[model samples]
Target chain A: MLFKNLFHHFGRYVIMLGSAFSKPERASMYYKETMRQMNDIGIGSLFIVCLIAIFIGAVTAVQFSYQLDGTLVPVYYIGYVVRDMTIIELAPTFTCLVLAGKVGSNIAAEIGGMRQKEHIDAMEIMGVNTAAYLIMPKVIAALIVIPMLVAVGAFISIIGGYLASVPTGVMADADYIKGLRSFFDPFNVTMMFIKALVFSFILTTVPAYQGYHVRGGSIELGQASTNAVVFSDILILVADYLLAVVLTS
Target chain B: MIRTEDIFKSFDETEVLKGITTEFYKGKTNLIIGRSGAGKTVLLKLLVGLLEPTSGKVWYDDTDFFALDRKQMRNIRMEVGMLFQASALFDSMTVEENIRFPLDMFSTLTLKEKRQQVDKCLERVNLEGANANFPSEISGGMQKRVGIARAIVLDPKYLFCDEPNSGLDPKTSIVIDELIRDITIEKNITTIINTHDMNSVMEIGDNIVLLYQGKLAWRGTNEDVLESDNATLQDFIFASPFLQRLRDAALKRG
Candidate 1:
């Protein structure tokens, strides 16, 4: 029964996506919506994302330095560890996990609210494709903006590690900078962007599907919103594991 | 004319409409009336292509609505306009923006021309100069009027209004009824409304369809209402004792 239900939902999700990516009735209306969503997801989420990235880097450095206290390992190795950790894992995973909570649930709630209020129906009767009008812009905006956010977050995390380690006298500025510059593979940056793009698609389309087909009243809407965030977080983590296996191996 | 041939609709194991066939003519105020759960809303949705019927055909003039592809269906939908019970105005947009949305999407008119058309619609709906107000900021009656303005902004060939007088006062309901009636005749558009408001039934019902227990129980105009002897119609129209007495008194005079 559970497998059947999952398959049923998967089928519906695929069909919904097919309809959502169709040709628009008018190109300019879609462009306007896409720009609005870009501002909302990209610009609106920048500060919170940067704040979280800083804390993740600081905590990782703090914990690693304390653990390396009695070891013969070079103290400057802290910068290397933080840099790789952020680029390969922390930046894409943590930034998307946070966005899954903030933006995913919001997309679900906004679309679900429109469904409940018959705004979608109004658009449909007006000869507008509600799925394309509502979902495509959001997906496009997320795809374009989320990778940039992850890149910015990765840069900020490296700086955060340096500030936490070097300013507190745990390491010299030269040592930290050398550690950051050491053994950096360009492939890791590619992996970061790949994960970011995949995670952004998952977070956006999952929430849009949840919202567009939501039924019932406020309680159901709330449940859909919660499910959007939960499913997006779960998918992001699973994708993280899969990408690590593929990219690393 | 908009016609349905042997329409049947079912949800789950339960059937809601059992072979409903009717005609709503152009330039007429056609009404679908029933008690709650009588499938009035479902039938209205089916008419406007919002929901597909279980096993029947809907003819939008010469077009078989169900036979059309998505693009073709959309072309038919381009000529359709609807007013939801809640108005369904985009709360994020101002009244003028809401009215201009369809124009922006499909019309080739310049911005100034669009604004002029919107102004003309607002004036026709008796809501001039309320263009900047959001739906949430307006009274329920004003919001319904705004909904009417938005519905007719494109001068749709067909109009469907679901419970347009649902939450308004009697006076406001009469005004809304008259406005819809005038628009139907003025534009020569086919208009279908769903309501159980008795006042509305007697006020603007040019062709009334009464559904009961998933079937067509009665059909008539307001003039034929008081004199009709259909048991179900009598039971529904004069369910209250006061209405029964008023009908009795009116019948004696005739």
Candidate 2:
């Protein structure tokens, strides 16, 4: 019975979305909503992203430079390692993990609170499409801004890594740039984009489903928020590993 | 008119609404009076298709509600207005925007036309010039009035209110009740209210249905209720000190 109800709501949501997507006006509203959601996710999340990226970059460069020990593994290769790791894994996938914890929980909580408070019902009573009016924007925003944030993360980390690698003195500035440029792979960039796209969809859909299905009052709303973040974050990590295995294999 | 036939709803093991049936009249204030756990709110939700009944049917003017498609259900909801116990006004929006929400959603009315309707509804609720105030900016009674204005702005054919007078002084409660009753009469809408407040039962209860433990125990008009021989209803009515004296005097004469 639970499965049946879940499937029914999923089916209804799909059909409603199919119709909305076909309508230009509705689609326009979706674009606007997405932009609004993106601003909320990206702009509000800047501080955390920058903080994480700088530390991860600096730590990675310092560790690699120290391990190299003036030998075959040159200190300048820190930039290459940082670039590869950031573009391939950290920027798109790990950053999304942070966002899922921050933004995903917030979206779920706000929507769940609205549901508990009957504001969502009131919107339905007033003839607003709850999914289109609420969920679409967040999905759109995440898709658009998450990729850009990934790029920004990549840039910040590489710079932090360069600074961290400076004291090692195993390789000169010219050698570091060459190794960094040499390590750049188009396949890794595509991988980053794919990861970003998948993360955005997962974060938006899971949290939205959780929020929409929320029952009970304010207390339940808080539970929904916590559940959305925990569940989505776990799924994202699992998906990241599975995708990594599939691509690597 | 709104009608429920053999509607049954259960939350897992506990049955909240057993085979219950009742009709709410058009252009009259119909009150569903019950104790706290009597499933009044559940019944209200079921009637409006918010919560699907476990068994039986709910009809809005002879049309079985659950039988309709999503589009049709949405269409039906547009004609139905509900006032929640908390007034349920959007905390984010001001009174004007809240009232204009329905118009923004359903109608293609110009901004001017929407504003005009908002002004008229606010004035009708005697809440004129409070349009710019947020829900938190106003008193609880004012919030209820804003809720009523939002409900009626769409010119709904049916109005449902769940404990509309739940948290207010007696004087303010009466004012809200009279406003709801006046709006029902003016629009000729089928108005159903779920409340245990005895004052509401007396103020605007042209028709009353007494729900006892998820079952329709007694149903009658205010006059009929005053003269009822039902012990359950007598106990409920006499729970109020003033009504107890009135019931005792009337019983002595009988």
Model 2, native contacts kept: 0.59
* Colliding pairs, model 2: A33-A137, A34-A137
* Candidate 1 chain A minimal-lDDT segment of 10 residues: A55-64
Residue-level lDDT tens digits of model 2 in B3-22: 99999999999999999988
Query: Against the true structure, candidate 1 has what lDDT?
Result: 0.94
i-RMSD of model 1 (Å, 1 decimal): 0.6
lDDT of 1 by residue, A99-129 (tens): 9999999999999999999999999999998
Question: Which candidate number maximizes TM-score?
Answer: 1
Lowest summed-lDDT stretch of 10 residues in model 2 chain A?
A19-28
For all candidates, state DockQ relative to the true structure. Answer: 0.88, 0.53
